[model samples]
Target: MAKIEPGNGLKSAESRKSLRGTTESLALTDGEGNLFGSDSELNVYTSERQTDKYGFIGGAQQYSEQSAENIPPEVLRQREAKWLDMLNNWDKWMAKRHKKMKLRCQKGIPPSLRGRAWLYLSGGKVKREQHKGKFEELDSQAGDPKWVDVIERDLHRQFPFHEMFVARGGHGQQDLYRVLKAYTLHRPEEGYCQAQAPIAAVLLMHMPAEDAFWGLVQICEKYLPGYYSAGLEAIQLDGEILFTLLKRVSPLAHRHLKKHKLDPILYMTEWFMCAFSRTLPWVSVLRVWDMFLCEGVKIIFRVGLVLLKCMLGSQDKLKTCQGQYETMELLKTIDTRYMQEGFLVREILELPVSERDIEKEHLASVRRWKETRGELHCKSLPRMHGAKAIMAAEPPSRQDLRQNPTIIVESPLATKSNGEDKERKNTKEQKNGKKNSSPTPVAAYLEPSEPSPLLKDAALLGSNQSLSSAEYDTYL
Candidate 1:
């Protein structure tokens, strides 16, 4: 047989080539390296017998190549549409992503995009880096000495003050301070608000200083307007707003509150001032913040309503403890479970939409108040943001305070006794970290049935009465 050439061909041809080539190679070998060359009758007959034997492997490769080249048209079309949609409508997608990022401030945004996403969503994303440099440059030459002093004073008092806050930081206080100082440098206008400190600390857990500063700016300017204001009116307005919402939703609770002379403002002031950081468990506050970012400031009312409603409804068989201090200890111990069940987290979750309704109702109510009080309502009063004028003039008697469900304003006569004494005592204890013999059991005295009559009536008392820290400070 003639020698065969090796080349890319089907199996039948290759097999023939193999046989001829075998013979040639055998002929060239030495005796020691023996090779089989003699072809028997079965060889030539069988070689010619199977021409199509190799077709299967060739067919498989061809089919595979064809499938790769010609991917299904619909799948390709769908993928192209998705890519085009992403390209054309990227901003919309980005906005939704940014909103999600804001809500997850506790977990922090991804480290890589943290700065960009924060600034962009706040409408500063594009200029965040540039603005940071500019602010730093300005801060070196332009920050006020007074602002720096104020910022320094407040830096440590911000986050992790309670055990609730301390649990959040794996990093020591030093890292938290550096981020806070850097932020104070970045946004000098805000300088450093009280609530910003805690919020910034939380942001630092997940972001760099610059991003945290801008995030603080967004919080102050966009989410909480009053917090940044010189007078701190936003918190006051919110307190007034919470009072109004409670009255509308739970009138029975409102009456009980009025009778006892308990001021919703007293307890909730801390809540609004601190954004619930000091009020609820730290994690619960973060959960509220998640909704806050998406929904805005009105979540404050939802939280307040839920809390007040919880306190009111659950006091049915509440056992009385000892004096005011014991009463307060008992009040503080009320479990949150029942309160949570009735006030739907899902409903609260939907409050960004609910807030629109609240804002509209709020605006209308303001208009109605003005219309009804036309001549008596002075320009200064509406702007004053005082709770006294908004509430009823007289405080409830100890008995009236018990029967009414609404929280009441205290009357002038009720505080003739030593109500301010308890306030002073508590203030001293708070300052010294010593438990005073006399507890200003405001929480205990604020019986769900008996609204703190002193609070409702206190509005009518002369200006000579002593004030709490929150009273003169105005923000809380």
Candidate 2:
């Protein structure tokens, strides 16, 4: 066997070859801070590589003479300039893209570069410039009634889990409401949908109001097509496809899951609703979004597939459980932090496609599956085959996934039993967050002489002041 140097040298020849194509060296400086390579040497190296990689089919001089290509003279000139710039910064750009993926935008994409970076990834630089003025134009418009109504329905229901992070009357909530209401007025056809809140909130961390709104617009119109329809057509389509992909990636887990009547729909609904809000940590979700912008909707599927692969290892540990609920109990305990850290964009690219070798084929199959399901030609649905819950008559909506600011109040009751039952329910809710439907709970069974905090708050908000003691107990 040949001896090998372990620390900085190649472990194997294959590893060296793999790195050769995509990797480049950092610029070397001598002890006295002098550059190593001259421009001529750098130019020669680049010219040879470009010829090998992007294959020149014709000579530029020959093409210039014979061209009836209808290409704009400016476009050709701009293309040449871009090629020169790329050659100049080839190593730096690749290094940055790699470093970006590793660092994972936790502190958020830098402010100044955010717009340009987003534009580059989504190929919307030119389009963004064309419509940049629209932000000011749209800001002058009145708020949409539809958005008001939709916002009303879900505002109180926002942030129903943690009191430390409630959405009630905060600056974040105010900004969210303003942008969402504004966008609804601006684009009446799309109006306001649910998932935009978190996306907007995330954007707001780095950008200003109008900028975040436009970013939201870009994500909605360009990226997540048909995501917020009344029928929830896009979410259901993605859900089915995720289930199919999940089954293939982990056969044993899939078998166990199926046997226990599990499906992706139950747990994975969060993945689609808030786009990984409740599933992954906030940092990981941001990391996923970085790729999501660059790669488009396909990254959603790729991330979902990776998540399912992560979920697979627990199935065996869950096999000895008593029932589906126990299996779910176990599944919920599966740590996702490792998967989120381990699976980078490069690893996602390398994930084995169980159905087809080509990405286009996988996407086409998913699209076809969605269309067929839409046509209702494939009406015979198989029973769930894993440890999962069947979604209720109404699946989780996009709005339910975001935090909003609204309040819920209970009505007064005459009957003693009804009043007592209502009070217990309200007390529980006051401790935890509000229910998805209601804002705050009422303490209905307070003593006749006692004053209630809710009643005091309601009174401050300009409600009726006069009430008898007996009725006041019910009202509070």
Q: Highest lDDT: give the candidate number.
A: 2
lDDT of 2 by residue, 1-476 (tens): 01123222223444322221112333423224544365355334334432311122112111121221233657655544443343233234333543443243322333224333443344333333446667667666667655675665443233322121133554545556777776777667656666565666555544445556766766665566556544444555556566566666766666666666655544454466555644554445545665566445555666667655665546465446646666566555545444443344445666665323323443665568566654422222221111011112112333332211112334343244465766788878778987535534442433212334554323222232333222221222
TM-score for each prediction? 0.47, 0.49
List all candidate RMSDs to the true structure.
Answer: 37.9, 27.9
lDDT tens digits, residues 1-476, model 1?
Answer: 11112221113333323221122221311123443244333233324432221111111111122122233657555544443343233354444554433344323222223333333334333234335375455434534655555545444344322221222233424444444555556555445554556666655544444445666655655556544444333443455567667777667556655555444434455566566654554335545654455445666677777666655643463334323334334445545452332233544554333555566655665565467644322122122111111112222223321211112324444443457877677788789998776433232223222224345324432322333221221101
The CA lDDT of each predicted structure is 0.43, 0.46
**Candidate 2 structure lDDT:** 0.46
